[model samples]
Target chain A: MATKTKPNGKSEKNQPQSTRLWLMFPPKLITRPIVWELGQKFPLVTNVRQASVTDEIGLVSLELSGSRGDIKAAIKWMEKLGIKVEPVEINVIES
Target chain B: MDKQTGFMKALKCRECGREYPLAATHVCEFDFGPLEVAYDYDRIKASMTRSAIQSRSKNMWRYRELLPVAGEPTVGCEVGFTPLIKADRLAKRLGIRELWIKNDAVNYPTLSFKDRVVSVALSRAKELGFTTVACASTGNLANSVAANAASAGLKAYVFIPSDLELGKVLNSLVYGANVVGIKGHYDEVNRLCAEIAGKYNWAFVNVNMRPYYAEGSKSMGFEIIEQLGWKIPQHTIVPMASGSLLTKIHKSYQEMTKLGLVSDAEYSVHGAQPAGCSPISVAQKAGLDFFKPVKPNTIAKSLAIGTPADGFYALKVMKETGGAADDVTDDEIRDGIKLLAECEGIFTETAGGVTVGVAKKLIASGKIPANDSAVLCITGNGLKTLDALVGHVGHTREIRPSLREFEALIEAETKSPTAA
Candidate 1:
């Protein structure tokens, strides 16, 4: 799902960026379509690079390309749903 | 680069294949893949012969060229070469034909395999002109870094979870190293260490110096091959925490085959973990390549890494080598510790218990056939984790210091139902 473009207004937080993350869904939320929800709720491109889902848990390696503010909000929303979100490999330390 | 860097060529990213200088750095910049020390295998093959390794001192340094060090090692020089025992009794008990225990429970400087990695990391840190070294440990690594750094005259700061065993905490405190206990788990401590490592120049062994520190585990694999008469075992079982040791052991086997140290043979490298925190094994059991993180809750504190750093690599190694992964309950872990102690006279830590327990399960389930020979890596000494076995082992029979009383106790024992 794509949002309508605002042609004139742009802020620093809305600057386009791409990021990767690892999302771990607990057993309770395993059946929920969280990735689909993440896409529908946020104006971002979500691509699942890899995923492993069992009855007990769901692990997804997702790549998101969108505005920085939108990505942050999506992550916060996932966290609020009791999903554990981590950077792909904690690259900030090495960077 | 005036000093000798042994036979190491450069640090190469495992994923992106980018090369970095041979320094205290870990991950690649682009893909965030872990950087590993790439070696000059041709030179290593020319010099690292069986006879050459046999002639060196009986320690982990015998495989010094393959280890990531510059010139001679200055720290933990006498770390490894722990015994590889032929565990016939244990084999019989587990219904396996042949079994061996690569017992690092009695490893030098500290009674754990962490000494091997600490030796390499601290020596490399010294070579890189660092005056202080540090690590984020569960328990064993802190004790090893504390003891090794003290011996090397380098200041050490070890961070651990506040709820570590008393023996491990005291082991570090006695070495005069600065031990910091975090209020959270090991992953938190490690995350904080990464942030601290970015700000300070101190060599955090598992963070900045991981590429070197991880190679130290290869020495254990090398020693096993040599101790087994220059032959690789058909099956080997290793415990998992961050899962680095299992992957490094597999790498060692491959390296030896490349260098013609051992004939290329088919072998499997299995992984074991506590059931409470077995993310990798759970994924492996489900035939999945990725693992979901779990909050650890087990008596096997040393193996309680919820988010194993090398979990992906460990899974890959197991899949490639036709190996399997399994975990055991806390009760099964205690039973494993007792089985090893009673049968083979080796008192290992909870990590070893996990290995033994999983081996038993694999053997019973025929994943590891009863007819094949296997080796179980016992990584730490039992004395370090006494809290796990306080009331589990059998109690001592108390009798007064009198022959009459002892005779009466013996007579009572003979009449007991268990004796019949």
Candidate 2:
């Protein structure tokens, strides 16, 4: 649906219900299965678009599909765990 | 673009909080701020060491941990690792204790430092799944892209200002690229390429893939430090075109120290530009953070970036390092080319002349410490810009194949054999 609920507590123009975020995990969090946690913890559809991981850190480009409120909550939850969560302007690759 | 540089975090906006997936996109969708590749330096440091780097190939790709690419490099993989010559003659002329030349004039493939960026750009484009690559350049970049893309088997479309030298034009076309000669300066051509990049699926290296392309210049810095016995030079001078190389070299120094590969020795980074289009130099001398763009009208067409994209960052690095910027005239540029050639036997192009000429001024003016070792970056080969030497260099004498005439000419010049 085009209409979406306000998560920032401000009324805004309707944004897409499905979106993506670029998640950066610090060295301390690299060993955790965050992708599994993302799906188990949130009601949103979690798609791991890209992941580059090493012993020091992990970065994931993730796409989520769900209601506006659920997508916002998913990102908020990730940020609470010391993960940097920011929206991703995607590439046309794999399209 | 590839799967290997997994240390690269998401593309973050330079001005805003916007972030982007590591893609071909450059500008932030929200505020139009440029997107730069973010890396987990901690991860890179964990994966890198002086011995680890020394064990790898001798080319630029050996610093794969720091470059933005994720997977194996697939373009111009053998480029970089040019010689760093110690210039005792040039240093003595400028009254300096020591001087070194980072001679990218002999860079692999296209004989310029542009080969370094082109190698990374084309490799990133392939990693991003771009079937075609394009760029707007003056001469060196066009030649580099064409050559690297041809070797990589990717379609290339290189656009350059129509008035480039004949040698550069021929060099690009010989690489089997589709060369488009636009009727404008490099800045205008670059502006047009920025528009074209958004419309087409093709990658415009300096336009859309700039963050990755710019990272390649850091290898020059890496090589300089590594070749200097894993030590940072007290002072280094780099030529400024779009200002990316200077900024990247400074970043390389900082990153090296951060990684514990080099000591945290204090070093200064100087910038060189031609007087005709010396925006960064002008800004530096005036103590201004920003620079006014100028129309490029110098023989050093390669360093004639009027509206430099990385000028702000370049100026910041200069200020932070306590280094200064200076410019040289077209006449001085020619003299510099000849000076290096006659003294060191290295025939550098106009851009190299700009660098050496500015170094001379900086040393003579006591801007750079006369007692410390200085490294000047010579960026291109003189053969590529031969037109710059048409009236500048001269043939001293003409002799016929007659023994009598040869003896008479030798006597006229040298007075007598013993006095000769």
The Cα local distance difference test for each model comes to 0.87, 0.81
lDDT of each residue in B317-412, candidate 2, tens digit only: 999999999999999999999999988999999999999899999998998979899999998899888888996676566678899988888878
Model no. 1, DockQ: 0.09
- Give the C-alpha lDDT of model 2: 0.81
How much is the lDDT of residue B108 in candidate 2? 94
* Model 1 bad stretches (over 4 Å): A1-78, A86-95, B1-4, B184-188, B417-420
The C-alpha TM-scores of every prediction are 0.86, 0.79
Docking class of predicted structure 1: incorrect
lDDT of 2 by residue, A6-94 (tens): 78754432343556566778788999888788788777677776677766557677777776567767766877898865444211110
User: Which portions of model 2 miss their true places by more than 4 Å?
Assistant: A1-95, B1-5, B163-165, B184-188, B416-420
Error of 1 at B116 (Å): 0.6
Which has the greatest DockQ?
A: 1
What fraction of the native interface does candidate 2 get right in terms of contacts?
0.00
Candidate 1, B1-420: lDDT as tens digits: 225677899999998799999998886766567899999888888888999999999999999989998688999999999999999999999999999999999999889998999899999999999999987766788889999999999999877678866766788889999988778634344445655776699998887888998999999999999999999999999999878999999999999889999999999999999999999999899998878788889999888767777898999999999999999999999999999999999999899999999999999999999999999999999988888999998678887899999888789888894752
Taking the candidates in order, what DockQ does each have? Answer: 0.09, 0.02
